[model samples]
Target chain A: MVQALIGIGIVYIGILIVLSLRSRREIKSSTDFILGGAKIGLILGFMTFAATLFSTFTLMGMPDFSRTHGVGAWLFLAFSDAVMVFFILWFGFYLRKRIGQQSFRGMSSLLQDCYQNKGVGYLYFTAAFLFLIPYVAIQIRGVAIFLLEAFPDFISVGFWSVLIVLIMLLYSELGGLKAIIYADFMQGTLLLIVVWLVAFNCLDQVGGWASLFEKINESNRALLSPPGPKGLLTPQFLIASCIAIAMIPVTQPQLSTRLVIMKNYKSLLRMAVAVGTFAMLIILPTIIIGLYGALYYAEESTSGFLGTVLLQEQHPIVAAVTIIGLFAAAMSTSDSQLFAMGNEFRGLLGASKEDQLTPVRVAIIVFAIAALLFSLVSSDELVLLARLSFSGTGIMGPMIILGILSKKPMGSFMIWFSALALLIFILSQLNVVPQNIYSFRVDLALMILLSLGAFINYRLKK
Target chain B: MIKNWSERKLKSTWRIIYWSAILLIAVTFSPIVLIQDKVDPHWLQMPFHLWVSILNTIVLVALTGVGGYVFYTLKSKTDNDQNL
Candidate 1:
């Protein structure tokens, strides 16, 4: 088992290195480094997005959730995706036309241009990198754990995670955007295939759809629908879920630039529908793995149902796939987050005196390394941090809609709104958020409402 | 004339079906996207996770519908140009 795992790891690393080396050849210009020379086709773009979006957390956690929460577990994926779908619709066509007017415009640059505030623009640059670095670390650590079983005690999970981060950084540094995109294309396909394998294994074991649903009901009826746990009910849940969905376009840096890359103005809405659907389709297997683990293990005390599967079977490959999914998730998030951060800094930050690709590669490596360290020193893995952070960014709706509208003074307004949103989210996760409004719901409605108020105020003043 | 109309209608038929089916699944699965299922329900006899399938059902349909519209529109435009 160890041998097989080891073999896969070495081979996988080699494949990535070779791919990155070739991708490096294309980095003749900054454009090639940043957006794959701005010559991405639909397939590569889709794959890159999917690769970045789909990852280890999604891979292992979906199954874990199915086991623990049942049907309601998928709410975030279904709804949050709609935000991106809407974004693609709203921006893809217009932005394609807009990009035609400008040679190179990153998301932050777009914001700064629209808002007409350099300070606010720089703030966005700083904020994106600040939040993203820790986020990427969580992803790197996740991949490391997956690679652990393959290694001797010589390389700890943290080491493996950092090693991969370095690998990504090296390629990203050398090969630039071309390397990341091509690698993303390869990684994304592997992730999809892995998803299918896990899904198939789940289906075969669970006895198909009819049989699976039967199992769901047999264990807990409440798991099948909303108002799930009597205590889980709250207006906050519904609102936050929706707002989170609506805000997808703004929060995910990888998502925003996709529009900048597309050649046609008409493809946005089409891509939205397609990508939204694609996003949901990809989410299915993780949920299945979660449900399957819940049923087979039936261990209420299991830390995570997906992890329990490994303990029960001692199946290294299956375990590896799940781990890889987590890695994929982290990689997806890290690469995109790094990519977005790099783009933001190359223009707005004080350190804009360099090639865009070089800064970006350094930024990605630095962020990934920091995240790994934080993951090692911090409380939990990226998955936990991601979820907690997601609940925070879930309110990114008001920020994107309102901030984008009024590029006038009141940079403070946007910053405060984002800070307040993050505060409410943290409080909610910590279970100290205003319980008087409602009980134990981790609500963000009031905060978003307040942000919306501020946005309105900004506009009124404008 | 009816055959031509029939073909056109057939082409658009997927739009409605695709949209509706995607919506159904998305709606059905919204309650569950990526949340952890704590236990099995009383109704079913199996222990399988339906979240993946539920999400897949919705997404696949949405793609079929929305993605289909793009390709179809592009194709129709070319056909018109060819005739022109």
Candidate 2:
């Protein structure tokens, strides 16, 4: 198993290095570096988008989510993703029409131009930085912890996390966004194959699909329904989660940039459908794995269950591929996010495109280091932390949407309102403010308020 | 005039599909689909809500494809008109 892991790991790294060097040659300008020359075709576009959207969170976090929370976990992620892809269709069209093909720097820079206010850009950058760093951290931490537990004698979590970050930084710094996209294409394909293979083995062990659910029913019937045994997936939670997940393409720079860099609307449309299909296919297997865990390792720790199912119980070669796939999934997401942050920072700068690449590269390294530090201290509750990141960034959705959809010069009020909402959302996360107000989650309420605010602002401006 | 009318009709059809997808998503989370304590009507031994939601998701993805086609038709027509 160790030899297999070493062999596969070397091959994976070799591919990433080759992709990076190839991409480096293509980086003739900052546009090429930052936006992959803004000419991504349907297949690469969909693959990169799916890879970034589904991460270690999908592989590690989600099966555990279903194991603990139950089938409503489906609604929590997969259904929300279905809705999100549809949203990409609508929002991507308008956004592309608004920004045109050439001039979109990043969401923050676009917002600055729309509102003619630097504060909006700063607000966007702050929200993304505050939320995305933790997200990237969890990806690093998730893989690091899993590695530590799987090979208890191998290395410390700190070493694994640092090594992952360094590899990601080197890869992204070498190849830029084009390199990242190519890497994502490889990672996404590997993730789907590995997840389904593990799921197939787990299902076979549990006596296939029908028997799997039957065993789950015998263990905990609540695992088959809404709210589960722990009562976490309530209607409000699902709805708020749905809205937050749906807002991802709008609020998250990593995804929204994918929308912009597609070769054309035809490519974007095809990619959206492909991503929706990929979301369904990828998430379908996690349910089986989760149900398997619910029946067998119900009392085990997350790392214990994952290590047992992903490594101890699988074929050695399969386990090796799973490890490499997990690494790819983690890097696929972390690098895009770190690079997107750099892109957003570059957007806010007043420098020339050539001058901006150096600082942008510097910012990517800085963000990667910050994520590495955060990963060391962050908790292993991967899905909830991920949801928090989504909800945190989703607060900026209406502000971004209004900027994209409205043609006229928008007032500054929505910008400030969004900023305040973001602060309150952050405070709520810290328990400085209650997470719910009068039976409504604060994030949901803030999203509603900001949406209304944007609508009214548009009307008044018109 | 015929082209304008046809484009308008295509635009309205696209809007309908888009809003219908939104409505389906909203209803999927409501009590209609998320009924707790009711796992009887199982398909392939999967629970009621789980299979139902799965089917719903499939429909939604299909709707996105349909919606995209309609949108493409509308967009292409408008582009053609502008070019003319």
Q: What is the C-alpha lDDT of each candidate?
A: 0.57, 0.90
- Tens digit per residue, CA lDDT, model 1, A220-244: 6665654354434223454465555
- Over 4 Å off in model 2, which ranges? A351-354, B1-5, B79-84
Q: Tens-digit lDDT track for model 1 on B1-84?
A: 223444456457545645655565455445443334434443243322343434454555455445445434544543332211
Fnat (0 to 1) per candidate: 0.11, 0.64
lDDT of 2 by residue, A201-279 (tens): 9988988889988888888999999989999999989988999999999999999999988888888889999999999
Error of 1 at A140 (Å): 2.0
- Which docking category, incorrect, acceptable, medium or high, applies to candidate 2? medium
Give the clashing pairs for model 2: none
Per-residue CA lDDT of model 2 for B54-80, tens digit only, reads: 999999999999888788778877764
Q: Show model 1 residue runs off by greater than 4 Å.
A: A6-11, A97-100, A149-154, A227-235, A267-270, A300-329, A350-359, A378-384, A394-396, A403-443, A454-462, B1-84
Model 2, position A219, has a per-residue lDDT of 80
Error of 1 at A402 (Å): 3.8
